[model samples]
Target: METHRIEELERKIQEYETIISEMSAPIIPSIVPQTILIPITGLIRAERFDKIRGNVLNFIHNKDIETAIIDLTDISGERIEDVCLEEIGRELHELASSISLMGVKALFVGMNPELVKRMVLDGIKLESQSFSTFQAALKYLMKQKGLEFRKISE
Candidate 1:
């Protein structure tokens, strides 16, 4: 009886961890139609990246997302900072390519300048459309669709 209780507790703990991991990287819909924005933040481990990739791919497959904006501006944590920038860049590039193969345009935004410089130095070419900000990417996408936003006064 004691062993069974312990196993049940462990199983519950694993379930909670999976839920937290899923909550960490959320795929939000953008104002532009068929565009989804995924803001990646905090410590990025191999496991976390896997969760993000899986969730994004599942979301895209279910929805008619034409563009995916992967914003990495908030990817700054003590644990993540220790990881090699080159490795992260390579993984991101690979993810973009995978998304492209699925017929969705991947737009990487908010990349750190230092990281970008490192990628350039390492001769790692990004295959997706990159922008300095999410707004810029959204604006460009909206323009392509002949859509414009007008400011309204209260």
Candidate 2:
């Protein structure tokens, strides 16, 4: 009787161990699609360029996002110093070139008065690279990919 009880207990323990092992098995993580939207804020300083670069790389690596919108709505309206404007233009040009090289599309939205003035003074012809608003930029970007824009009520 004692021997039988020992065997039964061992068997039960083994069964429980098996059940726990099965429950503890590693689970495969699910992949979810992510969208890329970056908003530029405040003064256009050199440090901000790093944020933009990091954000771009992060989207490319983590989200696999091909479309990005840089909104400059929060930027203050003031005359940009020539040196600062030059730096800003250089950064913009670099970002545009980088996105184009990576086969990604980038649209700069929110053309504030200060930005317009700086662009005019610097003779920076953004052409299709910049847009007046996020909605228009989105439409233009979608159009470039042969996609139709759907109107959403604000």
Candidate 3:
């Protein structure tokens, strides 16, 4: 049955494509327990937001992710005309609010400079604890949790 082999190959290809699609939006585990980092990068399309939100919410729902730090440092602005940064800002605020309602603290880090400038001019500000970098956010969380980094062996 050559047809059976062809069907199996098609199924495998579909699975691989789905995996690649999910991998496009990654969620990383942090050094601290109950914390995770989600770095938003590249041109985030409107349709992709639903998938992103679904994945993030699903992951958080499944695990004890107390704090979620979203890093936007790598978010590209090359396709500035294609999407509205203000809309994205609103979405980010909504996401943070939703995470908070779930008993999780959602922080932001490293917002793109261009985005910041645009949002400032547009009077769109995200109401979340934002830091300059991912490390800064991590340190802030660690301090809030009564933890600190120490060199036990150097």
Task: Give the alpha-carbon lDDT of every model.
Answer: 0.84, 0.61, 0.81
TM-scores for the candidates: 0.89, 0.58, 0.82
Each candidate structure's count of clashing pairs: 0, 0, 0
Model 2: which residue pairs collide? none
How many collisions between residues are there in candidate 3?
0
Q: Per-residue lDDT for 1-154 in model 3, tens only?
A: 9999999999999899668658766899999889999887656777666777778888888678899998888775774435788877777877887778778888999887777887788787666789999989888889889998888996
Q: Candidate 3, which segments miss by more than 4 Å at Cα?
A: 1-17, 79-81
Number of the top TM-score candidate = 1
lDDT of 1 by residue, 56-132 (tens): 88888857889999998786535475467777888898889888877899999988777787789888888888998
Q: lDDT per residue, candidate 2, 28-88, as tens digits?
A: 1112122355666544556546556755664476445666676766665452323476567
Candidate 3, residue 112: how far the Cα is off, in Å: 1.3
Q: Rank candidates by lDDT, best first.
A: 1, 3, 2
Report the candidate with higher TM-score, 2 versus 3.
3
Name the runs in model 2 displaced over 4 angstroms.
1-35, 78-83, 125-128, 142-154
